[model samples]
Target: MKITQIEIYAIHLPLIEPFIISYDRYDTMPSIIVKMTTDTGVIGYGESVPDDHVTGESWESTYAVLKHQLAPAVIGQNPMEFEKIHEVMNKVIRDVPAAKAAIDIACFDIAGKTLQVPVYQLIGGRFHKKFPITHVLSIGSPEKMANEAAEHVEMGYRSFKMKVGTEVMKDVERIKAVRERVGADIAIRVDVNQGWVNASTTLRGLRAMRDLDIDWLEQPVKADDIDAMVEIKSKADVSLMIDEGLHGVKEMREIIAKRAADKVNIKLMKCGGIYPAMKLAVMAEMAGIECQVGSMVESSVGSAAGFHVAFSKKNMTSVELTGPLKFSKDIGDLHYEVPFIELNEKPGLGVTVDEAILEELCKFKDVVKEG
Candidate 1:
C-alpha cells in the first residue's frame, strides 16, 4: 500500500531520576514520535530520542527534518520498497541519523503489518523469545551506587552496568562496592561514555578495574583515538567494547582493522535505524566481534524495534534497553521480569501510544499529508 499521511509529535517524558553520563545530565526524555498511515488503513509508529551529545540531534531539528525532508520524500512511495525509501531520504539530506531512523522504523513496522508477520520475522526471525537486559546504574558515590546495585540484585537481576570515567580512584571504589554488595556470580560492566580523554588515564582506569571481574569496559578513551584504544586493549586484562566510536560500517571496519576493541555496541539512534543497526551487527558478527543492542531514553515503540533487532541476531552478547524502566510512562504494553523483557505476540512492533497520554506529554504536533 502507498503512504497517505504522516504525523509527528514532540514529547517530553520526565525521568524517574536524573540520568547522568559523562557529557551531560538528563532530567527529561525529549523525543520525536512518528505515525505513518497507509492508504489501505494500516498505521505504523516510530520514536526518535534526540541527544545532541550522542547523535548530534535535538528535538526541534529532528522534528523539522522529519517534517520538511523525510515525510515529503516517503509520502507517495510504496512502503514495501524499503530501499527506495532510503534512497529518497538519503538524497534529501545528510547526517540526520535520528530523523532518518524514525521514518525507517515506521516503514519497517508497516512492512511487517503488510506481510502479516512480526518485524523480527521480517528482519531475521526470532532466535530467542526473551533476552536478558542489563540495568545501568546512574553515576553516584560508591555507597549510593552499591545500594542501587543491591536493589536490582534483590529484584532478581543478575547483570548490571555501572557508569564510570570519573576520578580513577572513585571509579575503582565504585566497582569494588558494587561487586561486594552484589556478591559473586553476577555480571558487571562499565561504560565511560568517552570520559577518559588520554591513553595514560584510560590505562590507569583499566588497571584499577583489572581484577574487578568486569565483563567489559566501554568507550574509556576519546572516541577518535583508535591508537590509544588499541594500546590499552593490548595491555589491559579486561576486554573492551567500543560504543561512541562506532558510527556506521565504515567506522566499524576501521576499528576492526585496527584491532581497537573486542566488542561493539549498536544503538538505533547512533546507527540511523534498524536497517543500519542490523547491518553493523551482522557485519561485526561475521568478523567474530560480539554485538550488543542498546537504546537512548526512548519510549517503548523505539525500544521494541531495538528488541527485535537484538533477538534477530545470533551474536548479540547483551542488551541495554532498560530506558522504559527509568521512566514512569511508556507508549506500549511491555512485561519486565528482572533481567528479561518479554515481547507481545502481536504483529508489527505490537505497541501503541495512548492518545490521552500523548496529548498530555506532547509539546508540539504536526501532520504532513500525502500530496
Candidate 2:
C-alpha cells in the first residue's frame, strides 16, 4: 500500500522538573509527531524530539521540514520500501536526521501493522522481554543529586546516569555523593555532554573521580574532537562512551579505527530512525562494541520505537529511554514497571496514541497530501 496523507503536529510537553545538563536547561520538551495514512486504511505514528545541541534541530525546523519537504517526498511511496523512502528524504533535504526520523518511524509502524507483527519482530525477534532502564538525574547540587539517587533506589532502580560537565570539582562531588548514597551495588554512569571542552580538563575531572567507580564516562569533550576523545581514552582508567560523536555507521567506524571510545550511545533521532539504528547496532555487534539506545526526551511514541530497538539487539547493553517518565503528560500508552520498561506483543509500535490529547497538546498542525 502507498502512503496517501501525512499529518504533522508540534507539541510542547511540560517536564516534571527542569532538566539541566552542561549546556542548557529544559523545563519543557518540544516534540513533532507524524501521522501517516495509507491507501489500505492503515495509519501509523511517529515522533521527533530534536535537540539543537545534538541533532541540530528544533521544533520549528523539524516541523517545517516535515511539512514542506520530507512529507511530500514520501507521498505515493510504499511504506515498506524503507531504503527508497530514506533516499527520497535525503535528496529533498540533508542533515535533518530528526525530521527524517519522524517519517522513517511512521513507515516502520505501517510496515509492522500491515504485516501483523510487532516492530521488533520485523527487525529481529525479541532478545529481552523486559530490561532495567537507567534513571537519569539532571545537574543539581551535591546534596540534591544524592537525595534524588536515594529516592530512585527506593523506587527499585538499580542503574543511574548523572549529568556532569559544569565544574570539575563539583562534578566529581556530584558523582561521589550519589555513589555514596546509592551504595556500591547500584551502577552509575556519567555524561558530560562535551562540557569539559578539552582533553586536559576531562583528564583532570577523570582523575578526581578515579576512585568513585563510574561505569563509564560519556562524551567528555566536544562531538567533533576525535583527537581529544583518543587522548582522554588513553589516559583515563574509566571506560569512554561516545554520544554526540556517533550518528551513523561511518562515525562508528572512525571511532573504532581511532580507538576513541569503548561504547556508543545510539539515538533514533541522531541516525534517522529504527532502520538505520538497527544497522548501527549490527555494525556495533560486528565490531565488538557495546551499544546503548538513548532518547531525546520523547513521549511514548518515540520511546516505544526505542524500546523495540533495545529489546531486539543484544549488543544494546544499556538503555536510557526514560523520557516518558520525565514528562508530566504524554500522548501515547507505555507501561513502566518502576525500573523496567515492559513491552506488549501488539502489532506495530504497540502504542496507542490519544488523538484528543494530541490535538489538545498541539501548538501547530499541518497535513501534506497529494495535490
lDDT of 2 by residue, 62-147 (tens): 99989989998899999999999999988998889888889989999999999999999989989987889889999999999999
On the 0 to 100 scale, the lDDT of residue 302 in model 2 is: 94
lDDT of 1 at 203: 84
Per candidate, the number of residue pairs that clash is 0, 0
Query: All predictions: root-mean-square deviation over Cα?
Result: 1.2, 0.9
TM agreement with the true structure for every prediction: 0.97, 0.99
lDDT for model 1, please.
0.85
Candidate achieving the largest TM-score: 2
**Model 1 lDDT tens row, 83-157:** 788788889998788888899899889888888888889888888778887889988999999999898888888
Residue 142's C-alpha lDDT in candidate 2?
94
Off by over 4 Å in 2: none
